[model samples]
Target: MKLILIRHGESEANFANYWTGWLDVDLTEKGVQQAREAGRRIKKANLAIDCAYESMLKRSIKTAQLVLEEAEASFVPEFKTWRLNERHYGALVGKNKTEMTQQFGKEQVQKWRRGFDEVPPLAKENYFDRRYDGFDRRLLPKGESLRMTSERVLTLWQDQIVPRLKSGQTVLVCGHGNSLRALIQYLEQIPVDKVDEIDVPNATPILYTFDSLLRIERRIEL
Candidate 1:
């Protein structure tokens, strides 16, 4: 079975260089162009996807839709799951990255951005704080480290995604940077410390094929 993973296109937040976590912003013109290109690339590759999955966020949904449309396969089965959403950046949802770098120092911001087990502190009762309400209250209140994100993603994979893969379905997962990283960690069995080093760029599709034994036979960055 083969699985294709994709990241959403650029967003307004991406253009403004702000933190976008559960912000629900739409894609920019450049983002749409990127998605269109992704669609073209996928179509050219002649990959026939059987199943599609995306984050609840519209950015991922739009990307999936455009890609499928370009591939002439929009009629395929697809589902959405909150488990595939971006890593919640807590209090820093709309904060300016430059200002954050100036205030907290670039090193600190970088640490929070890329640290495997560390999480930025949540805002004190704000929009970003409330975004986690749907999740387990206890886990939400405490905030989530990337390690924790990986654990949650693993739960979803073991309980849901793996079953579909075991049934010989080719899956396409559209999601954000950190959440996708979590999925990669689960699929590739990468050490938590090194997970941040895998840079999955915006709108790029990664394809992985597994043998009947469920071992990876090919992993291609398409």
Candidate 2:
């Protein structure tokens, strides 16, 4: 089975150097081009994607749409789930990363950003977005550590993605940096402390070929 994981293209927040968290933002022009390039790369690799999955955010949703269109695989099944959204940054959502680092000290910011269990400060209130109306309110997080993000993401992978891969299906996942990192950590069996070293770049696809038992046979970046 084959699995392709792509982080969503750069968002306006990313271009502005702000912490995006769960905020909904559109792709910049360069981000759109990057998404197209990613699709073309997938096509050039001759990988047939059976289905695609993305987070509920528009940036991820748009990337998936653009990828399918560019790959001429628009007919493929697409799944969007909140479970794949970026790790909630809580009160830091709109803060500038550089300014935050200067104010809080680089080490402290690094701990909040990459530490396995160090969750950032909670948001003032729980999110009340209409898009998440149907989901359980308690499931929404005000803040999350990488470990917490991994738990929810792994649940979705085990329940939704693993079965498909086990049946020999090829899947494409367009998601955010932290969420994808969480998934990669699980798939690659990276140590908790070592996960801090993993960084998923924007609009790049990480392709994985799996054996019958779902062990990774090979991993390639495109």
Candidate 3:
């Protein structure tokens, strides 16, 4: 079994330096080209992609579609789940990073961005915070830290991805950087502190192979 993890291409928010968690934005023109290039590259590699999963987000969906087109495997099953969205930056959606740094100070911003357990204050639009809206906010609520993100992704792996791998299905996941980072952190057994250092470039894919017992054979950048 093999699992391929990919990040979506550069989004307009990426060019604008805005926090885009659950914002439902689309890919930019350059992003489209990048997606095509990613597709072409994946096609050239000729990996046996059996099935796929993506975030409900459009950029990831589009990237997955483009990659599948390149791979000539558009007929494969593709599942979308909100569990794979990027780390939601509370109260920072649509804000400019440079301006944010000027106002909040770079150190504080960096802590919020890169710290493993530190989650930013909740978004003003708590309605947008689907993870914690109506389900007893005081107890067993869910907005995610990077650590929490890892936990969620690992649960998804255990419940969804791993079973398919054990069944000898080659799966692909197209997800956000932080979400995918969370997955990689667990998949590779990397330490919490070092997880943030794993830079997942846009549209880049990470491939992992598994043996009969579902232990990882190797993880490679493809």
Which candidate's lDDT is highest? 2
How many Å off is the CA of 32 in candidate 2?
0.2
The TM-score between candidate 2 and the true structure equals 0.98
Model 2 superposed RMSD (Cα): 0.8
Best-matching candidate per TM-score:
2
For each candidate, the alpha-carbon lDDT, in order, equals 0.81, 0.93, 0.82
What is candidate 3's local distance difference test score? 0.82
Task: Give candidate 1 regions above 4 Å deviation.
Answer: 126-142
Question: Clashes in each model (backbone N, CA, C under 3 Å)?
Answer: 0, 0, 0
Ranking by lDDT: 2, 3, 1
Deviating ranges (above 4 Å) for candidate 2: none
| Candidate 3 Cα misplacement greater than 4 A, ranges | 127-143
Q: Which ten residues in a row have the lowest lDDT in candidate 3?
A: 134-143
Pairs that clash in candidate 1 = none
Cα RMSD to the true fold for all candidates: 2.4, 0.8, 2.9
